[model samples]
Target: MNSPQTINGLMRHLRNDCKIQISGSYQKQQLTSYGYYHGYKGYRFAGNSYRQIPYSDFSEVVAVIEYDNNLKAALYPELMFIETALKNIVCNESVKGLKLGTFEHLYKERMSDNTTNTKLQSKRLKLRNSVYAKLAARYHDEEEKENQMVRHFYNRGEDAPIWVVFEILYLSDLAGFFECLNEAVRENILKQMNMFDISIDANKNLLSIMIYTLKALRNSVAHNNIIFDTRFKDRKISPVLKKWVEKETGIQNITLYSLIDYIIIVCCLLKRVDFSGTRALTLLNKYKEENQRLQNSVASEIYDHIIQNNVPAKVVGLEAYLNV
Candidate 1:
């Protein structure tokens, strides 16, 4: 008889591991078959299921170990990716009349690609001076009324073409994601306010800065690049700006497992031009629910695990922007 190291010795190994005691009288009695817990017995391969057969029929025996580890290795990582991408889509598409209002556009373009998107890219001043003029005309007394107009104009809806909505959301600020996030950062980081109190330029340079930052984050995820441990190579922001980059870009540093969360923040901020600083968590929840079936079937448990560990709070601190 071959030793245990031989592939054919697996049956002998299994027999030794069994708790059932076999008497000497039963050992020589023709052994037919054996079964184990959890469908290990009668496992079929190549038209073979454990059945009573003569020893001559046992040409070869191979053992395969199957067990459930339940580690869910990619749960958080995949969730992070999905969350970030969806965030960008929802936020960017919420803006009204943005030229490149499609998730595909946001996914494809980089900061360098910003220069090529002429009509796709425009300063908020230009938008306010033109289509969103009512936003600029309002004062403290009628703040609520003016905010309603902005929401009506920019809210993402199925009525409009998907691309148009995406452009609006991506190009818009992320202030709508969280009210506290709004209060934490500079109001004019993107320089939406007009400079020199003259013609509507609205800090064209600042809008350009925002454009490039979003482009970098968008491209990184679209290309399956690493997010948590990333050092963006082609970033255009200065060292001082890097500290507040997430704030300026409207990225709430929560559990940045995916790029979608950041994108949603940007979309909500852009809607702020006309919105009353409403949060997008409700919408985010809806999106997650819609995809729950697939998530569950794929055995992805990151979202649930995150809630259990409360690890997301430690990953990104939106409150830090308040200090910056």
Candidate 2:
């Protein structure tokens, strides 16, 4: 039902239908670089099928896409670090507290909580089984023989240690595993991560929520999803931690919908875990650098307009982290 156009035809349609002003060769070069589908079509702001707010210039769309690409590049490494660090902390603490490495032990001692809600218990058991199945498959795979941990566990015939099993678990699985933990075990991991001020119950709940959020973020970054304009589905941060972020960032109305707020959350967790957060700082600096570069370009006003009207307000606090 849809007709295809050449790149130049697409450019003409953008000029005529979208009312975008294509200035010169530079804008055309950008269109060539980013492609028409992603560079132009993706950035359209439409309220309905018939009504659309045209980008003032082609450069505006290019700037937005470039900023998003830069952000994704900068965030990928830091997010990976945070994911690994959180997994390691959870597995180490859970092993010590629960006093077992095997999947059966974890399921029986920690995951098999006596819940009043049968549906909730059933959901958790489903997650547990899924994790077990994945780990078991990975454990027996011939390709995984080179993995020292996998080999060690396979030879032992006992279910793998927390560390070994973690070698195969996705970040989402790790977060789900944390949720399945007994309150005491979860609280121990939280305390170990330096969340001492909060009560054990609050810490357990907060960590569960934060990890879930981080898992979502990690998946997005890992899978090369657009980072800048993403509004998270589960945007609620725990009240106590929300207050802490408000204090730390000096941003009064912090919401997880903003990518900047998510970065701040990652920085907060890194600080709690004593990571120094150098990668987060690098990301903030990179953002500032990109913003500065845009300011010096011919597209400065367009860039400013896009940022002011479209980008998240929490992005303003990115500069503060440079001094930190």
Candidate 2 root-mean-square deviation in Å: 3.9
Candidate 1 lDDT tens digits, 1-324: 954343223335444653222333233122223223222232222112332211111111111111011111222333334334444443433333446643323322321233444543443224323322333332232446754433443354422333333233332332222111111122233334221111222322333334444555545545544332222335434432333344443443433333333434343333333233332333334334433432343223322322223323322333332223
lDDT of each: 0.32, 0.67
Single out the weakest 10-residue window by summed lDDT for candidate 2: 45-54
What TM-score against the true fold does each predicted structure earn? 0.26, 0.80
Q: Ten consecutive residues with minimal summed lDDT in candidate 1? A: 62-71
lDDT of 2 by residue, 1-324 (tens): 888886677778878877888746676777888888765666554212243333677766766677767777877877777778888888777767566677778778776555776865876887778877887677567464565666565677755666767778877777777877777777787777766445324546567667777776777667765566453334566676677667666766656655666777887676655456466566766776776665565354555443444234555664464356
Score candidate 1 by TM-score against the native: 0.26
- Which residue ranges in model 1 land beyond 4 Å of their true spot? 1-206, 216-241, 245-257, 264-268, 274-276, 286-295, 300-311, 314-324
Q: Best candidate, lDDT-wise?
A: 2
Return the top candidate by TM-score. Answer: 2
